[model samples]
Target: MHLLEGVAAILVSVCIYAWAYGKHHGPGAPGWAKGQLFASLISVLLVALFPVGAGFVALGLTEAMTPASWAGLVALAVLPVAIWKAVPRLARRA
Candidate 1:
């Protein structure tokens, strides 16, 4: 079940990321927007690791992760949104 869930998360995340990239990363997009899009892609990719790791741990291939690790993963998942909002403002001031 964990493995299946992890697979689903990966599939969904990748599909969404790919759609967003295609929509927002056209030639006319600003450098800041492209940068943010890539940043969000990285953030979401890292976020997807949590489920994969969980699946691994469930299968006893690895030990459980620390609470801080889990918290950090959650933080990374949210970081993209923060970057998305902050980068434009910073670019304008530059």
Candidate 2:
């Protein structure tokens, strides 16, 4: 049960981050995109680092997570963005 919940939280955080990242990053984007990108990065990082406690703070039925779990969450959280930056896009000339 705990593992499943932790996975879910990480997934949700990454998905939300991806949505915000896609919205802010692209061709012909607005000038404020950098700010948006920064905010989105911070947003995901916080959620990933404090998955359970974040929810428990409001609901008050959860316990805090350990440091190792936080590291794992960080890895999961950054994987998508890392791949995005590392992989090449289609139909593009460099």
Candidate 3:
């Protein structure tokens, strides 16, 4: 189960990273592009450990030991920048 999650996270992060790479180090939104690259890298690590939250819960452990929570936490931390940059293009398409 953990392996599957790790693989999925790796694939998702890699694909997004590949797409985001085009924006990074380019004549584009520097902060937004950098965030995507950074978020993707962090997400790969976080997502793999996301299930750690469930483990903590099962073991009556605190959230402090739950690495899974950081997956969404990190995503939330970076989401605004990505959305801020993408909304314009997304809105134009819609």
Candidate 4:
């Protein structure tokens, strides 16, 4: 059950991150979105794997992260603006 929950959390987090990335980057989003999703997924997975990390994440959530997560959630909430800002710079160098 614990393993299942961990897997579910990883899946959910990846999906959320990918959805945010896609919304920001649009249908034509670059590989960087995937990279960010992967990075987020790895971070969560690492937390799940390490009991200490999991405790810290839980504590952080209870204290600092609740607010920070809201900010991140808001940032993700406005992904289109981020995409608009990022795509041009990405295009310029390429």
Per-residue lDDT of 1-94 in model 1, one digit per residue for the tens? 3333444454445444554455455556556656776678657775866567456435532335566446545544665575566445433422
Against the correct fold, how does model 3 do in TM-score? 0.30
- Which one wins by lDDT: 1 or 4? 1
CA error at residue 28 for candidate 4, angstroms: 9.6
For residues 3-37, could you state the per-residue lDDT of candidate 3 as single tens digits?
23333343344444445455554565358656765
RMSD per model, one decimal: 9.9, 8.8, 11.1, 11.4
Candidate numbers sorted by lDDT from highest down? 1, 2, 4, 3
Residue 39's C-alpha lDDT in candidate 4?
59
Local error of candidate 2 at 11, Å? 0.7
- Stretches of candidate 4 above 4 Å error? 27-94
Q: Rate the local accuracy (lDDT) of all candidates.
A: 0.52, 0.51, 0.47, 0.48
The pairs that clash in candidate 1 are none
lDDT of 4: 0.48
lDDT at residue 83 of model 1 (Cα atoms): 53
Poorest stretch of ten by lDDT in candidate 2: 85-94
Tell me the RMSD of model 3 versus the true structure.
Answer: 11.1
Candidate 4 clashing pairs, residues 3+ apart or interchain: none
Candidates' TM-scores?
0.36, 0.37, 0.30, 0.31
Candidate 1 segments exceeding 4 Å error: 28-32, 37-47, 50-94
